[model samples]
Target: MTPTSLELSTLGHRIRHQRVSHGLTLDELGERVGVAGSQLSLIENGKREPKLSLLQAIAAETGVQVTDLLSTEPPNRRAALEIELERAQHGSVFRQLGIAPVKVTKSMTDETIESLLGLHRELQRREREAIATPEEARRANTELRLKMRDVDNYLGDIEKLAEKQLKSAGHVSGALTHRTVSIMAEQLGFELIYVSDLPHSARSVTDLENGRIYLPPASIPGGHGLRSMALQAMAHRLLGHQRPTDYADFLQQRLEINYFAAACLMPETASVAFLAQAKKDRNLAVEDFRDAFGTTHESAGMRLTNLATRHLDIPLHFLRVDGSGAITRVYENDGLPLPMDVTGAVDGQIACRKWSARSAFDEQNRTTEHYQYTDTPAGTFWCSTQTGTTAEGEFSITVGVPFDDAKWFRGRETQKRATSTCPDESCCRRPSTDLAERWTGKAWPSARVHMQMFSPLPRGVFPGVDDNEVYEFLDRHM
Candidate 1:
């Protein structure tokens, strides 16, 4: 294996220690090893990777074995400090400061190096703390979303695991039943318990010691919410996830558990077969898929994005926009022009007013899905949006594909069409010239600021979760 920088530094320190003990100068060692003195100096300073042959020659000249030259341990405390300082200098945290790195010299005292290392540690801690901010969270979400897009949002390992769990629970076909979910939990040595006193900050809490999965008594309006939450809790165990190290790691775990839950709710083998047949019949619809899987409209739509692109070769986008038109959740691989902030994050950005996701709010028939074809700077795309209400407020779940792939969907014939020029101020953000002239210097609207905008993300083992509340709840039950 190729040696890491730290390993090289350790090896170099060991070689230099041996040379010093033998009372040999660089020239004397180099002459004995058949290498230039300057080259030997570079090797001794860990500035160059030495070949196996060179290492063997050096070991022979120093009266030691090759393994001794390759030892990972630093020769002395000074060597350890130097290796650490070297690593800190090359780190991203130091590089981003745009300042010259402090060079380690033979004259520098160990105490000075220790103080520098302490400062470096403090800088690293502050940097990690900064990542818990909302802007950093958004940036991390954007990066994860883009990565999911690149992979077509499909995860085969989770899919296979879900399928295996379902089969083990004796789920052969149809919608996965509550009994089957219970059985699956039981098989995993967990008993699903309904309780009225779940922690306010937690959706569900798994008590590993008691082998109980405590859930709220009331089910969410859509059928799959409770099961999905339970499965997500179980996923933490099945996926072998540890406490997240950073905000990015926490976001990743959230995505993974959600993915695992969706996979369990909609088994890939069965769901794909059902969708494939639907596609063949040219009757693919989100509502139909939702009915078949007995999942929420949002879950069905998101699941389609996961499977459709990978299995059916149809690239698409999905969006979940709140009543005020903020893009709460979005995934696009079809070149849909989404409004993004300076950090390339689209979560808080407003969706175009003319797009179906926003227009669906004004539809008279809230019972049915609103379908439309929208022309934008990127291209024409068809979308079907379903608006629903929760405790939070009304939100719309939308699934759309490019114009060419629209023919394969049920809402392809809808004559409802609109145009959007988003990311352009004139499209929706800016007022008309007449309206601007009339309202300017007169309008002093008080903007309602969300508290989350000002607050730092919760600090603890789990972000946003009250650890005390959770521990208390577990104690009450245990």
Candidate 2:
């Protein structure tokens, strides 16, 4: 490109000054800017009007701006970039000189900008190659597994994250979905395999066709049901390539799906048979039950909790409560409908009331409404359950065990505050007796266990559940 006489001279002079200021020898500047030292000298001396584009090239190479080359006011547009490059160059000089290059600054000169752009492109290229490489893929898988393990460690953290997300949107992040979960899983190393069958033989399976992973759903008997839908939703979350964001939606889906998964792990028929055999001798103990089924305590409790639903005589839900009296997990077996969010209410405090059972069938049926004080080797624990429902007709049944039981899963000192003891010295429950330890190693039936825990409807919290109204709302869209 041609240059105006003034612009050329202006550009040449800027280029010369920038080159010298940046501490670049003529040969170094020439090599960097794609111009020979002799040619550059001629241009600097105003013997020739270099191509306008050449001025851009020199500006870029020297970390100066094109406007700087063409302007006469002070340093021009390129001066800032040149100054930055000079600082960087000066730092390198200091480093070579055995001095600390402590106060370094960044430059945005043409050459530096070009170098940055080139570096970005190069990094992108390398990333593409890394993704395609088997070794890199394996490394990615290892990293993903490590992350998943960490995720398992902070399930409480996950619950908190979910709760925060739910309170924000009444759902998780919209971007969190099955696809994202699957992608994350693959990156973490576990393969996601999707299947269409209730109680699928495998929760996850490898897909040889595409050499990818699959997380299949537990099938429904007839291949249709809300439960199936929930399972599929969870599959999308857990096995798919997306991380789901809707905490409430995710919980609704995950619990329903995994309830079936845990159910299918030891199918209902088998569980019933085993429980029947155990009942013949005695109520199944926790360790014996876990050993017989080779399952976690929570898993075992869930299976047992499912019992009350099928048999009315055993109307109960089992939960592991923390010192703060928060129910971390709930398992339902005896009752068709149990109170929902039982976990949320008793989450971080001791339930110091007798177990109160409520039902959708009878809102005021109070069974075992009195707390029985008990003592045991471990300590005293107040345990109870009450039934209530949100205005939406979502039921919640809650039961609490001692916070010390948490040690079964985690080896840690039991916090006294969880047993209803006050944190402050002036509090009433101070020096409170250990309710759980008071009754430890006892063979009390569910009803006879001594602790004060109950669930009643939250005064103002209501969830809506009117199928007809829901249908009507949908009809409006139709």
Candidate 3:
């Protein structure tokens, strides 16, 4: 990697930390420094560089002087070597010298180094455009999320369309019932099937011409994943989405479909009213709301974010993390800064062990709720999380609000706090010096697949379904 690119990540990380430390949202900081909030967001994410004047203003406002922002020590031997290899890939000098650069991060486990090297090779050739690695995909997605800043992460048009459709389906103004879901499907000319042998490539599928939808058996072990999958299939037909041209549009489209599916499952009017009542009762636990709506924890958590940002005006963030500690999905609307990797947003990157989502993996029961406070360079955020295990793997669903806003929710009472400065050296870059002195080449030997970090999240063509399988199934149906 070029030093400039590396500097971008480092600079963004520090400035974001400083901004959050000052308890200033991007909008507030932008107002203070006279830059657009969207531009500030990109600068904070390391995707954009600030002008000299803007940099001066940022230094004055955030107290992170220019030198500190620009200064990033060269990467450790491992990362430095990787960069040198990338730089020499086409260099005539390296070609003459035969200076083969081995792909590895000396500090990380061998497996991770391999996975990253694999990703680097995959994207090393093609010209960059939206889709390359999971990180690039997330960067594109984050940019889309940032665009919604003006609308507070609420796509009002999509939400309004969903409500109007729900009303026409006779769910005019109440909680959506499974019976009502069945009714809506029939009204849309779809026949729903609960199948025991549906291929594993998808959670659900639809045969539009045949007017049939397929779902896994209800007895399947795991979170209520099938519910959302089935609804998403229904949504594809209802929303009339054209084929997406690229991953960014694909991701953006799925988010809209998810909004539609959630509206159908939780129905905005009643869900909002119920949440309002729950807020009054100081019982905003997501589990209770999931139970109340008979939805899965993931769906419940997503709906909570929607309600918080769009309806309640509560400003919140949501995280869906794998048991392995990778952030599978993130929705950040609350102004708290999220740390991103050199590749992109936190997606597919390992979360700090100190994060609530990471801790949720340790819960005894697969479904018990976890509540905790996480203190980051940004600010403290109170979070409620729960685990859900499926055939795919166990993952955590977490919803958090900034510390200042936590008082309105029930989980604010958590005394446990985790300190984190992620994507930073102190977080996980090196072995603990004291612990290392004792073990020092004695017992640290393990290598699991951090492969999730390098894999692309297959979305768009079908949310959870593999795109190839979707095409095959549709072909067979026709």
Query: Against the true structure, candidate 3 has what lDDT?
Result: 0.72
Give all TM-scores, in the order shown. Answer: 0.75, 0.28, 0.64
Superposed model 3: Cα runs more than 4 Å off: 1-136, 148-150, 172-175, 196-199, 217-227, 363-367, 441-446, 451-478
**Which is the winner by TM-score between candidate 2 and candidate 3?**
3
Per-residue lDDT of candidate 3, residues 123-226 (tens digit) = 43222232345555667777776675556666667677777767776875444655656667788898777767676876677776688887877666643455
Off by over 4 Å in 1: 1-131, 218-222
| Residue 180 lDDT (model 3) | 59
Candidate 2, overall lDDT?
0.42
Q: Across residues 80-158, which tens digit of lDDT does each residue of candidate 2 receive?
A: 4433333343443334546443321234346655464454455444333322233332343334323433332123333
Backbone collisions counted per model: 0, 91, 0
Q: What does candidate 3 score in Cα RMSD to the true structure?
A: 21.4
The order by descending lDDT is 1, 3, 2
lDDT of 3 at 230: 63
For model 2 the TM-score comes to: 0.28
lDDT of each: 0.89, 0.42, 0.72
Best by TM-score: 1
